[model samples]
Target: MLILTCPYCGVDAEETELAPGGEAHLKRFGPGASDEEFRDYLFARENPKGVHFERWRHAHGCGKWFHAARCTMTLEVFGTYPAQTTKPPKAIREAITAKRPGWTWREFE
Candidate 1:
């Protein structure tokens, strides 16, 4: 089972203990953006078979939303971080790099 540690409550929660909240760190296309941009944001998304970033809520615990880096193929968790920022924290990125070399998600280089 996929276990995630809550940054707020310090609870290591299993997959059922949390709620899947879909993709994380999505760039919002608003205001002056073209129609295609908004449509893509609403309809199109990355559904990779490998490394992916996602949002989750500690439903049975602190009830806080957080980001998690997970491997879709192997179900390996890289790490979890706060969801306030636009990308995964530096440490999480480094951890993923150490385990899975040449892995790149969007602009997180």
Candidate 2:
């Protein structure tokens, strides 16, 4: 089991306390965007063997959606930030500082 810190709740929570949402920072289609463009946006995922950015909802905490950089293979959580926060995190930075592949760093940007 992994522990994730809810940026809002400010406490480390079990992975059970959260629900995996989807790819993070998915771009929305603008007016007149083509079907192919929309389809790519909707269905594509990196599914990288290493670190990946994902969305998670604090289902048992603040009920807020947030960003988490996770390792696909190890299910390690690197860091967490509120989705509505002003600044996005530097993905590489979080991944590197994560003590283990499964520990989450709770820091606000």
Candidate 3:
């Protein structure tokens, strides 16, 4: 089972203690956006086979949401970061690089 540490509550929670919040860093397409753009924002989500960034909530703990870098294929969590940013932090990126060299996710290197 995956273990996620909630930075706010300081709880090392199991997967059951958290809730998946889908892909993070999504650009909201609202009222003024074109129909196609709105539709794509709502439905066109990337489901890649490898590394991906997602949002997770510490539902059973602090109830705060955070970002996580994970591998879809292996279910391995690279690291977690604050949800306030649109891109993964440098430390998390370095950790992923150390574990899996040549890894690239979106605008992160």
Candidate 4:
């Protein structure tokens, strides 16, 4: 069972208790943007086979959203952080690096 710690409430909740919000760190396109850009924003997503970042909501807990770094194939969770961060926190990044060296996600390394 996948378990994630809610950064807001500090509760370790199972995946069944949370709602997935999809890939994290997406670049959103708004009004005045080109049609292609907007279209890509709506449909384009990273479905990597290795380490991936995602958004999760503690639906049955704190009801707050957060970001999590985990391996898709192994389901090994590196860590979780608040959703307000623009990128993965230093500790999370380090943890991932320790496990999967040379790993890079989006612009984070």
Lowest lDDT block of 10, candidate 3: 100-109
Please state the error at residue 90 of candidate 1 in Å. 1.1
Instruction: Name the lDDT value of residue 42 in candidate 3.
Output: 90
**Per-model CA lDDT versus the true structure:** 0.89, 0.73, 0.84, 0.91
Ranking by lDDT: 4, 1, 3, 2
Against the true structure, whose TM-score is highest? 4
Clashing pairs in 2: 76-101, 76-102
lDDT of 4 by residue, 15-96 (tens): 9999999999998877899999998888999999989999999999889999999999988999999999999998988898
TM-scores for all candidates: the values are 0.90, 0.75, 0.88, 0.94
Candidate number achieving the greatest lDDT relative to the actual structure: 4
Clashes of each: 0, 2, 0, 0
Better structure of 3 and 4 per TM-score: 4
Off by over 4 Å in 1: 31-33
Cα lDDT tens digits for candidate 2, 5-108: 88888878888988988877677799799999989988876677766667888898889888877677887776788886444567645455555456433343
**Which of the two, 2 or 4, has more TM-score?**
4
Please report the TM-score between candidate 2 and the true structure: 0.75
Answer with 1 or 2, whichever has the higher lDDT.
1
